[model samples]
Target: MRFFLEFLEFLENMQLMLIINTIMKMPTVTKIIYRLKDEGLLDTRICDNDNRVTQVSLTEQGWTMVEKINEIASLLLTDSFTGLKPNDIKKLNEYLKILKANLQ
Candidate 1:
C-alpha cells in the first residue's frame, strides 16, 4: 500500500510495465493496482497509442488519501521520536541513509 502510494506521488501517470519493473514482481503489482482501482482510488486504462500498455493515475480521492496518510505518518514519526534530541535524530537519519545505500 505504501509502495503504491509513494510511487504514484512522484509520477503523475505510470505504465503498468514500469510499475512491475520497479517492484520486480508482476503479480503483486497487478493485485495492488486492481485493488486500488476497485476502491476508486486509482484510475487505469489502456494507452491509446499502445493497446498493450496500461497506464494508471490517482483519482482525486486518492490524492486526498495520500495527504491524510502523510499527515498520520508525520504525527506517528514525531510521537515515536519524541524523546530524541535534534542531534540524535540527525545521526539516526545519517545512519539510515547509509543503511539504505548499502541495501541498494
Candidate 2:
C-alpha cells in the first residue's frame, strides 16, 4: 500500500533503497520488494546510471489494486458520512482528531 501510494504520487521509477529507506530498514525493504515482485505487483530493473542500484515501479496489476483500494476507501468514507450535516461532520472530525492525538 505504501509503495503504491508513493508510485501514484510520483509516477516514475525510483531507486529501491532510496524509497524503502524512507519507510523501513534496507534488509526488510529488499525482502518485501522481492515478495512484491514475485506477486507480480511490482517490477525492478538495474539502474541505468548505477550498477549497484536497482530501480522499482509498479506493474499493471498493482495499479488496478490501487484503484480498487481507493474506490473501497471512498465508498466507506461516504457511507460513514451518510445523513450527517456539514457542521456535524466537522465536529466529528475534530473529535476524531482529538481521540487520535490522545492515542498517540
Candidate 3:
C-alpha cells in the first residue's frame, strides 16, 4: 500500500512536471519558477514591448537537464511496455483514444 501511494505521487509529479515544461514561458507559469531561476536553469527578462511583462528562457544547463529528464522518462515508458504484442499495443492505443475522446 505504501509503495502504491508513492508510485501515485511520483506519477502525479511527472505529469505536473511535463505540464510545466510545456508552458514555462506564458501567462500561467508556476511560482516554482523562482527555484528554477535560483538553480540557474531559468532566465527571465522584461518584454521589450511591455516592461511589466516577463519572458522566460531556459539556460544551457536547463536544456541539458531537460534532455536528461526526457531520456529517463523514455526509459521508464519503454520498460513499462516491454514484452507486449503488436496487436495488444494497438488495441491499448485504440482504447486510450476512445477514453480520451470520451473524457474530453
67-104, model 2: which lDDT tens digit per residue? 77778888999999999999999999999999999999
Better of 1 and 2 by TM-score: 1
Query: Candidate 1, after superposition: displacement of residue 53 in Å?
Result: 0.9
TM-score-best of 1 and 3: 1
What C-alpha lDDT do the candidate models reach, one value each? 0.83, 0.75, 0.62
* Model 1 residue 37 CA deviation in Å: 0.4
TM-score, every prediction: 0.79, 0.74, 0.63
When summed lDDT is taken over every stretch of 10 residues in candidate 2, the lowest stretch is: 7-16
Tell me each candidate's RMSD, in Å, in order. Answer: 2.5, 2.8, 9.4
User: 4-59 in candidate 3: lDDT tens per residue?
Assistant: 22232344324444544564643334455556778877677776897865556666
Ranking by TM-score: 1, 2, 3
lDDT of 1: 0.83
* Worst lDDT 10-window in candidate 1: 11-20
Q: Local error of candidate 1 at 34, Å?
A: 0.4
Clashing pairs in 1: none
lDDT of 1 by residue, 24-92 (tens): 687777888899989989999888898877788899999998998899989998899999999999999
